[model samples]
Target chain A: MESWEILLQQVINGVSLGAMYALLALGFTMVYGIIELINFAHFNIFMVGSFIAMWVMQLMGFTGQSHVLYGLPLTAMLVFVLCVTMVATGVLGALIERFGLRALRGVSGTAPMITTIGLSYILFNVILLGAGADTKNYSNPMPNIRWEFGDAVLHLRELILWGVSLVLMLALHYFVRRTKMGKAMQATAQDQEAARMVGVDVDRVVIITFFIGSALAGAAGVIFGLYYNYTNFGIGYTAGLRAFTAAVLGGIGNIPGAMLGGVLIGLIESLGGQYLAVRWTDVIIFSILVLVLVFRPTGLLGRASPTKS
Target chain B: MPISDAPQTQSQRRPPLLEFNDVNTYYGELHVLKGVNYRVGDGEIVCLLGGNASGKSTTMKTILGIVRPKSGVVTYAGKPIDRLPTAERVRRGIAPVPEARRLFPRMTVLENLEMGAFTRTDTDEIEADKERVFGLFPRVKERLTQLAGTLSGGEQQMVAMGRALMARPKLLCMDEPSMGLSPAFVEQVFDIIQAINKQGTSIFMVEQNANMALSIADYGYVLQTGEVVLQGSAQSLRDNEMVQQAYLGEMKAQ
Candidate 1:
């Protein structure tokens, strides 16, 4: 491929990948924002979503067959499968808040973070034991369609991913800025006691935050599985770590910052891997994170005040 | 002015709205409130006057249940509340407008007021209380939708007081409401304090402005080194030689 063509392809690839990371980072950022704890189990929840989607599709007998419903063309029945998975994952996130995080409230910061890390490992192992170590294939295969614009090409799956992620981000922004619950979330994020003082059910708001963040991650997992057509038990740890890094880069606890950081990180990884060696991607990305932290500990947008402080 | 017209109950017979008996508090191992005792009767404005680190704020915190008193009893309405959490205390009609006017900076003035009644379940009652607060402080109404952080210091103090009133507390505890206000605003705040008391909310206030506090207080306690050294009715405390010299300025003989 020509340099310009390759660079354009890299940009497209970066954005598609970045959108997935953004979804993951949003979950990490939201949970961390209200509680000031790193929810290590979030990534595992994402993996669970992917598995759930796979199981749902298998049960529905959705094997890449197109169908017509209400005069509309449906590519695959797996859309419903993905939706169910997202909701299930959302509920799981809420359960974690109710059971795991709630008990650790007012405890030392290190204790909760360690607990989450432990839970993440436990979840990873449980999935490994149940689902086995082999990579699972989804029932809905990625459609191999490419639109050519001059010498450049756009994959259909990439276009769909970008479009859906952008819409999700916009909806999130609107929710946070406009809706009552969203405003309560912002208030809670800013000052939990103050929010509680205002008659906001602080506990309810925290749980809702977990659900929304997790749903986004779950949706991303389904999209990722559909795009790549494969999933494994151990995918969450690395992806979760990267998403967390993205969150820090954009400023942890800041909503828009998470998206921005995610996209920037994706660009760096894709472009760096293309220009240099693919294996050097993590090193380059981490080095940039180090530089950004040294210069601005707050991240690109700046850190919101942590709840306790 | 209405103080004289109200039926005079046996001058010494009314039960105290709040009573603290030999309360002791600590942060880690450092004892803050050392056997502190105080009481405020219904409709009375009691001032806890002390210089820096005399445990004025800590006293207020203990009453508000922010600082857990290790020993002794704090009773409100004849029920012990030393063990209740701060939120529960606020629910039970004890509200504190903390020092420095800890307003929610990002929230609008109206939102901050609403937060004061967080424990209230009746929407209509809360709305009515908000209107009452607005009526009490017109400035707050004027800046209802403005972010509290953008308000002037005096305005922030008004919002803080208004927020506490929204709770409809029986015993309103104010910690240094005049700490960082202008001299004019300080006078206004003190006057508001009197008006609030007249409205039937007994007040337990901590103040560094001893002279002004004593002038307005029905009863006053002078604290030094976390202990009350002198206490009496306001008029009597105002007449004592040491109080006159140290706090009240030279007495004018009739």
Candidate 2:
């Protein structure tokens, strides 16, 4: 690829990749913000989303041999798949919250954290057993539409992914700031005891937080399947770790900070991988994280005040 | 107002609203509440007065079940509630407005009030109680949509008190309502306390402002080094020589 074309492609790829990271990171950050639990099983939730979508698609009997849904355009089928995946994954997230996370409330910190890791392993193996160890392919009917602007080209899939992520992030911002339930969630995050004292159903708010955060991860998984065109039970770990880095890069608890941090990490990874060696990507990203922590322990944003217990 | 001179009745002989008998609490290995004993009668405004590190707050926490008593029992209305969780305590009509006005910073004043009635099941009753809280603190009504954290210190205190009142508790516990307020705000807080006491909800409060707390409190206990040093009617405690020098400040020489 030419220099200008390469730069353009990297920019597009970086944004979509950043959006995926942001989606997953939003879950990690929100769960951490509310309960102070890292929720290691969250990554497996994303992995499950892909498998759920594939299973649903197969059940629908819309084989890849034909590019139409009930004689409708292939786009509609893809949209249906996306919507179904979002709902299914959202319900799965709620179940995890109700049964898994809720059971561990008020317990010792180490126990829950370790349990989540254990849950992650269990989920990974369950997916392997159900779907087999083979990598699954999801064919996107939306062809790779490339828009050539002078010497640069932009892929349509990248644009769609970035657009959806931005919209989701913006919606999340409004929900947290504008809605009554969102405020309750923030209160619960800040101080669970205080939130309860005010009559906020801290438990309900926490469950809602898990639902929303997990749904976001699930959405990212759908988009990842569309963009990458491949899925496996183990993909969540790599993506989840990267998203975690994004969360830490932005202030962990602050919402907008997560977006900024995610995009920054994306840019570094893509640009660094292109200019420097691909092997140096992790080293560069983590080095930046260490430097940020040493200089500003609170990430880019200032430290959060300790809420009343 | 003149003191009621009516003869004692059978109802008056009933157990107090709240009773703490030799209650002890620990933080890790550090014993905070060392066998603290106290009681508050129905319709009484009782103050737990102490200096810093005297375990006044810990005693309040023990009553609310935020900190489990290592030994002894904390009973509310003759029921052992020492083992109950904080939410269950609130459901049992035991509400606490903690020190430092722990308002949900991101939530609107209205939402905070809604949270106050979390355990309440009746929508109409919850709404009525909210209106009552707004009536008590009209300023909160005006800032119904404003975030709790953005409110002024005195305003936050009002929200905290109103939030507690939403629970409609039989015994309302407050931990140092005047910790960070100005003198005028301090007086305002005490006035609200007295008003709340008059409205039939028993008040059990811990305060650093011993003189002001005793002034409004019907009964008072002086805590020193995690133990109750003295207990009596507010006026008698106010007049006690040790209390006068230690907490109430020395009287002017004639």
Candidate 3:
């Protein structure tokens, strides 16, 4: 294969990975934007989503990719698993907000943020004890079919990952931009006092934001399992950071920016891993984050702190 | 002429749409409102005037329950509202045009206006209210698709007022409607406030623009430190020696 072909292959690989990161990043940006909480646990929510999807697939009697699902049956099973995983994770995220953070709403900024750190640790340990610390295999339903174009090959799972993420992101964008509830969410995010004065039930909006964000993270987890075919307890720690980086890169709190940042981060990871080792990906990502913070703290799409605030 | 300088007599004269009874509020350990007692009568444009940190804004906040008072009762309509949340107060028909016209900068003007009527579920009336808001501020209609933050200061104020009106407010509370505006816009805003008052919406506003506020308001309250120093009809307050020396004494715009 030519050098550019190899780059293209890396690009495809990066986008598929980035799609998952973007979803997680969106959750981070949105939750941060509204409440000013870093929600460290959101990362593990994605991790939990992956674990749930795998367990559900196993429960449904699908074990391995050797006798992989095909056509309608495959599509049906995937849809069922995806919906279940999204709801379960979404509810879990909402519950964390309701029981964990709701009581601490006005108790200074640091309190809730520290609680999120505690929650992240709780989730990490729960999965570690329940599912073990070892990297487990994901039961991928789709057959790993490769499509070649001019010496470059793309996997079917990659397309599904990209397609599903794009559709969900678009749906989320529409829900926020066009719907009345979406406008209320934006109002609450922009000015909580103003939103309340206008009679918006801001608590409900926060709950909804958590649900949507966590649901997207759940979808990303399913796709991550489908694409990488591996899972572990500690994945959220790294992947969540990557998504957070993507959110910042795209301009934290910016919806479209999160998508762009996610893809860009993915590309950088894939390309960097291709040239340098995979171990260097974190160093490069964090270095870029540092540079972005120093030079343009608002980020590529972040116009100013005003918009985020 | 309609009411007396004493707050006790004023409440008996007209059924108070909103009342504060010895309301004391604090932030952290610092006491803000000492003992604020005031009444906004039905269909009255009442203004609270004070210098910076005089607890004028806190009074508005307490009425809206943005900040709960450490002690005392706030009654709206006929019920005790000190315990109600801001959203609940808003549901009971209290709306605020907050300090600095805090429009959702990222949302479009239309979206911001839509948020104003968030409490209302009647779609037909919401559409009608949107039309009413458009009628009140034609410029807001022209910039429906424009991001609210990008609007001019005067236009943003208009949108803010329009947003407040969308709530179909029985009591419209404004905090510093003239805070950041050109002289021309301040007059325009005051005129619109009076016009809204003529439409039968009771207004309770906190302002530093003493002269403009007195001109349109039916009643006025002056706060110094954290207590109501004077309370009466706009005419009497404007005529009082203390109010003139303190608030209207200087013929200057804030």
Candidate 4:
């Protein structure tokens, strides 16, 4: 492969990886945006989402061959799995907010942060006990067809992953911009008291924020499992750290910032791994984070003031 | 006697649009509103006057259900609204221009207006109300796409008032509309307050600027240390010797 082709390949790989991170980063940014809580459990939600998808796939007897179920083909079944995973994860996210975080309302900021960390631990343990400690293989049913531009090969799976992430991002943008409920979400994020005074049901807004943010994370989890071909109870820790880094890199409270930051981090990880040793990829990512904190503390797109809504 | 049970004075016979009957509110152990009684009639502007820490804003919050009264009935249009949620009270046509014109700092003026009409489902009416708000504050129309925080103080106040009007509220509650404004802007704000009142929107305002508040209010209540010290027609409060010395900044021979 030519040097340019290698660069292009790395770019493609980075974007695909970034798309996964973007999914998780959005959850972090959104939860932080609404309530200023760094919800550690969000990462666990993503891990659980992937596990749920794997279990569903196994129970349904889905394999590499396209099989029809309920007049739906293999692709449709995948969509079904996606929907189920998203809803389950969304509900889990909402329940965590209701029982864990909401109960800590009006308490010191440290309380909710610590509670989420505890929730993450509980979720990790629950999955560990239920699924066992071994890493479960997540089979990719999609045909492994690759399109080549010169020496840079693009897999069909990468295209689907990128396409879905883009579509979800666009849908989220439309929801936040055009929909009434979305506006209410933004308003509630801006000022809960003012939002209430203006007739916004702030409690409902917080619940919906968790639902959407977690659903996105769930989608990411399913995609991560399908791409990486494995699921484990402990994936949430490393994955959540990277996504949280992306959120901070892009400016924690800003939506577009999180998206951009995730993609950038993905590109850096891929290219850094290609150029340097694969083991040094995390060191490289954290180095970039330290640089950002020291130089431009608000991240690339975040404003100095915490007013993104 | 329960203030709600007291018969309306003969001169003002219409049932009160909003009646705060002997409200007592506390923030933990700190008593904030003590035996407060006042009423705002339909299409009337009732201004609550006090210095800082006099529980004027707390009284506004009590009516909107943010600060629940320990005892007393807060009745809106003869129906008790003390138990209603803050959003529920706002949905029932009570809107507030809160202190410092708390516009969503990051949102565009247009989006802020959208938030004001959050409780309403009638799309056509909401659109019409937006137009009415624009008419009331043309500066807001010009700054529709501008982020609210970037606006000048006077312009922000316009957006805040425009946001409140977008609700098409029956009774508009304002907390210190004249706070942190130039003298000229204060005058302009007061003028707009009267103009809004003329359009059949009753106003319940809390302010320290007794001179401007009393000028536009139909009735007035003087609060001191969480208790109603005096209440009467706006004209009477403006001329009262005690009110003149304390609030109106007017002094006669000591």
Candidate 5:
């Protein structure tokens, strides 16, 4: 158990890393599905979510990176903060949709897209001005506990991250496929005019898409913070790009594709960072993105199967 | 030319379910519907006939509130819906079988039908409506689990109609229900449209197949370049030289 099973270790690391990217990628695919906007601000929503979780911990007098609440208390605190952060980020996403993109709905071309980039800057600058340029330590509520298995080790934290991700993703899948509102989202994505003909409030659908997509990003934010132990205004730049690549790698507008793409990219980053020169991680990730786009623009699962959105 | 008793030619035989009064709809600078005024009477199958770019589709869009009238009022069930959004119009007992049968291709036929009743909350009644749709188009029942996109063109049309029926609409607005069907399916579709109209829902259909449309329509309107050039009872229009020449393809061959 003392030996490092490089491959096994890399796979473990990749899954956890991929989990964060998966959550973030969900937001991109959904927003793109419904309104055809990239919502560049979504990356910052994850960053802001991390900061908000940090602040929530701080408000509870748990301010340091060493802030640890174990057993039952830890569970309660994590759940509380996760719920709060998801809501805050969901509302933030909805607000951006309402004021920022609603007016430019039918303006044609990249105006809405450019607005998203502008919105991204606003979110980034707000964090920069409100906090600081320096990387702020995120309070880790869970201790770095490990379980040994043969030559490899499993972190309880990674398992928890993966568990939470799997649940949220399943819930989202059920909602989209089974629930009325979720189907409305899918209907809007396929054909907005047809959706409207059936009496779906397309504008309202747009807002909901932002809410759900951004809320997932918020969860990723908390996970990202817990994994990396710190966050900065610039985290969105690197993390966001990776997640976007993941979304595009899967079908851009596909739900499950984003999740698959996220995990795949996360694994790619981890193994590439370890095996290749650590510096070439970004190049490898983007290279895959370029290859996927060039060869299969629809992503891995973007094939003509059902459940496209 | 046809059965004079197909439907009462009179506009007020029953109360008008939908009315467009001097409504002018614009797509930016292009005025699509020019001061259009029309009505769909309760329980009658009314068809709007026109060629391409003649504002037939825009007329359908205007009634559904997809495109708002720049001026004038659109009334449904005695309420003005000119300013209402498409959702509100649908809520007020209107539904559409849009052109090309725009089904959510990735969804199951059952799911597509469920979506037709998106605005309804009556669980028991929705079930009842589903049964009713299945009864009307029995093939839909067999393909409930199949993805809508996998169905044939004719089957898709059936699902589209079945989906519209799921809403329990008082007024069913259909655009080009016979556009791309084989002659046999076209006949079947017209027969189904009549059957639906007979079941107490009003029909407001826009079609380029004037010959088939006139056969089922109670009343008809002809639009040429965004203006109502001619309108009359189906029998009268079928007998008119202008209608025969322009729409019914009754012109003499060279």
Candidate 6:
């Protein structure tokens, strides 16, 4: 490929990678918006989501290629894995909120946040013990096909990645803007006490927020596994940190901000890796984080905190 | 003023819309409300007047179930609500214009009103209620899309009251509605309160301004620290020498 063509291909690749981070960051920001918890365990949930998808694939007798199950194609099996893992991770997120953080509701800020770090360890251990602390190979059922735009090639996985992320983001936007429960969520996120006075089921909103955020994170995990063709217990720590950074960069608690932050981080990482060195990627990204925090503390797109009436 | 001297006796014909029987609430051993008892009859404007740290707001919270009393009972429409959650209490027709308005700052005025009707399933009725709120506060209607936080103090108060009325509650609780408003705005807020009371919603207001509160109230209770010190017809309370000296400031200091 020519230099410009290679840059274009890398840009596409960066966007695809950013879509995954945006998915995870959306969960981080949404949960933070409602409950103000950073939810360190969310990253581990994503890690577990990938492992679950891999095990589900194994159960479906998926090898390196396509297969038919009960007259259903391998694509159908992949869809099944996606649905099951999303639900499983969503339930896991709800369970964490219920048992892990519910009782600690009005406790000091550091208490619940510290509890999440501990919970992250617990989830990491569960995956490590079950999956044997080793990297597991993921099967990509999608046929190897690429569309060439001149000398730049677009992979099927990239299409799936961006398509799923955009669809989910739009669905979330619709849910939060057009629906009743979504309105209630906005009310609760702003003021829990005020929301209760207005007859919003705030406890229900909290649970729903956790479930939706975690489910999105889980979906990101599945995409990560499929796109990269590998899964491990430790992936959560690194990926979770990156996604968390994305959330903060876009403005923690801002939905569209997380998406923008994710894509920006992805592009920065990809372009930085291509131009600078792979080892310098983290340095570049963290530098952006520090600079953003120093200059625009609220974030690139986030407004200053509105004064409560 | 069409003040009722015996609202309790009249309400005895039907159960009081809300009743607090020997309620005691605490904030982690702070002992906020000590054996407090109060009631609001149907369509009555009952005011709870007290100075700062008098457990007046806590009384409102206790009724709303935001702060569960350590002992005693809170019943709404003859059903015990002490064990109910705050949202359930709201669904049971208890809505509060909490201290400082507490409007969802980022949400528009219309969205804030919509939140008030969140527990209701009747869309037609909610639509009617929105129209009713607009009728009550034309200023709020004029700024339906404006963020609640951007409104002036008086306008924010209007939105707050409008938001509560959207719940279509049997009883409306107002905590320090006049806390930060100018004298003119305070009078306007009280007028709106009385107007709302005349519309068949009972008003249970906690206020530091005993004069403004008692002037419109049919009945009044004076809370000192964590206990009810006196209860009477609003006329009697306003006339009493002790009330004038302590709260109304009708007499010059000796």
RMSD of each candidate relative to the true structure: 5.2, 5.0, 2.5, 3.1, 2.8, 3.0
Docking class of 2: acceptable
Backbone clash pairs in model 4 (N, Cα, C under 3 Å; residues 3+ apart or in different chains), count: 0
The best candidate in terms of DockQ: 6
Task: Report the C-alpha lDDT of model 4 over B1-254, residue by residue, as the tens digit.
Answer: 11222234425734588998888999999999998888888899989988889998899889888889999999998799988999888888899999988888888899999889998889999999998888888888999988988888899888889889888899999999988889899999999999999999999999878888898888888888998878777877777878888877642231
Across B54-145, the per-residue lDDT of candidate 2 in tens digits comes to 99878877877668988999888888988877778888898889888788776678877877877777889988998888888989999998
After TM-score superposition, the amount by which residue B46's alpha carbon in candidate 3 deviates from its true location, in angstroms, is 1.5
True-vs-predicted CA distance for residue B207, candidate 1, Å: 1.8
Give a tens-digit lDDT track for model 6, residues B1-254: 22333666554433488888999999997999999878787778999988889999899889888889999998889889999988888888999999999999999888888888888999999999999888888888999999888889889899999999989998999999998899898998899898888888999999888888998998888888998888877888898777888888842332
Winner by TM-score: 5
Q: In model 6, where do residues sit more than 4 Å from their true spots?
A: A66-75, B1-15, B250-254
Q: What is the lDDT of candidate 5?
A: 0.89
Candidate 3 segments whose C-alpha is farther than 4 A from its true place: A107-109, A304-309, B1-13, B252-254
TM-score of each: 0.82, 0.81, 0.94, 0.95, 0.96, 0.95
Q: Residues A1-309, candidate 5, lDDT per residue (tens digit)? A: 343687788899999999999999999999998888888999899999999988998898887666766789988998898999999999999999999999999889999999999998999999999999999987787877898767778888888899989999999999988888999998898888889989999999999999999999999999998888888888888999999999999889999999999999999998998889779999999999899999998899884564422
Ranking by lDDT: 5, 3, 4, 6, 1, 2
Computed on alpha carbons, the lDDT of every model, listed in order, comes to 0.81, 0.80, 0.88, 0.87, 0.89, 0.87
- The TM-score of predicted model 4 comes to 0.95
Better of 3 and 5 by TM-score: 5
Summing lDDT over every window of 10 consecutive residues in candidate 6 chain A, give the lowest-scoring window: A63-72
Go through the candidates in order and give each one's DockQ. Answer: 0.24, 0.29, 0.57, 0.55, 0.58, 0.69
- After superposition of all CA atoms, the RMSD between model 1 and the true structure is 5.2
Which run of 10 residues does model 5 chain B get worst, by summed lDDT?
A: B1-10
What is the lDDT, from 0 to 100, of the residue B234 in candidate 5?
Answer: 77
Clashing pairs for predicted structure model 5, backbone only = none
DockQ of 6: 0.69
